[model samples]
Target: MNEFLLIFRRDFTTAADQPSAESLQQHYRAWKEWFENLAAQDRLVGPTKRWDGAGKVVRNAKDVTDGPYADIKESIGGMLIIKANDYDEAAEVAKDCPIFAFGGNVEIRKALS
Candidate 1:
């Protein structure tokens, strides 16, 4: 089986203007359920992590102070690594990801072995 890295992107702090604690808790609960399901199937590969959106971009030995990456929108809020047979399988696994329901996105890429 091949391993895939699922990059979960979302505007985690977008609700700051109209914060709803209940909604946030529900979203977190859904995220946890997804994690547990992946673990139960033994498909989880590593500890999932959330990325900080504010960071410098370095390319070709040049540092570019940027707030966001051109490649992605909303920023990479979190991620996970999972083992799957193929892209189709990986996509299938991603279908159960919580981001979709929460109006976010999950980008799935094959991990370099």
Candidate 2:
């Protein structure tokens, strides 16, 4: 099996875009269940990590900037790596991601050696 990376993206920067506490809890539960299922199937490759949506970008030798490209409609929120037979299988696994319920997307990519 090959490793695939699932990159999660979301458009949530303002108070209006934030989900309610109950909704957040529900989402968390869904994520936990999904991950647990993957682990049970022995498909989970590595620990998942969440991003705070804040970082710095280096453009040149001395030019630096605070990121996530504020002008964009969405920002990468987190990532997970999983084992799969191929890209299609990896994408199939991502189809059940909880991010979709919140109008987010998942980018599936095969991991390089």
Candidate 3:
């Protein structure tokens, strides 16, 4: 089996663009169920983690800045690794990701050994 990285990117930029608290709660539940399903299928690998809104950027070993990013409207919500037979299989698995429900996207990349 090969490993794949799934990066969840979503837009929660401004207050006006953010989802309601109740809607967020529902989305959280969906994520929980999705993880559980992957676990049950023996596909999950390593650790799963969600990122905070805060961030820092380092440049040329000198300059540093705080940011989620001003250039990009969407933020990286979280990421996790999973096992799959190939890119095709990984793509199939990613199709079930709940991020789609919230107008987000899942980027699937193969882990090189």
lDDT of each: 0.80, 0.89, 0.88
Please, what are the lDDT tens digits per residue for candidate 3 over residues 12-43? 87777778899989989999999999999999
List, residue by residue over 1-113, the lDDT tens digit for candidate 2: 99998999998867898999999999999999998999999998877777888877676778778786656778898999999999989999999999998999999989788
Q: Which stretches of model 3 miss by more than 4 angstroms?
A: none
Cα lDDT tens digits for candidate 1, 1-113: 99998888766555553337897788789888888989999999988776776876676797675756654557777788899999999999999887776677789999786
Please list the residue runs of candidate 1 whose C-alpha ends up more than 4 Å from where it truly belongs after superposition: 11-19, 70-72
Colliding residue pairs in candidate 2: none
Model 2, CA-based lDDT: 0.89
Candidate 3 lDDT (Cα, 0 to 1): 0.88
- The best candidate by lDDT is 2
Q: Give the Cα error of residue 30 in candidate 3, in Å.
A: 0.6
lDDT of 1 at 4: 94
lDDT of 1 at 108: 90
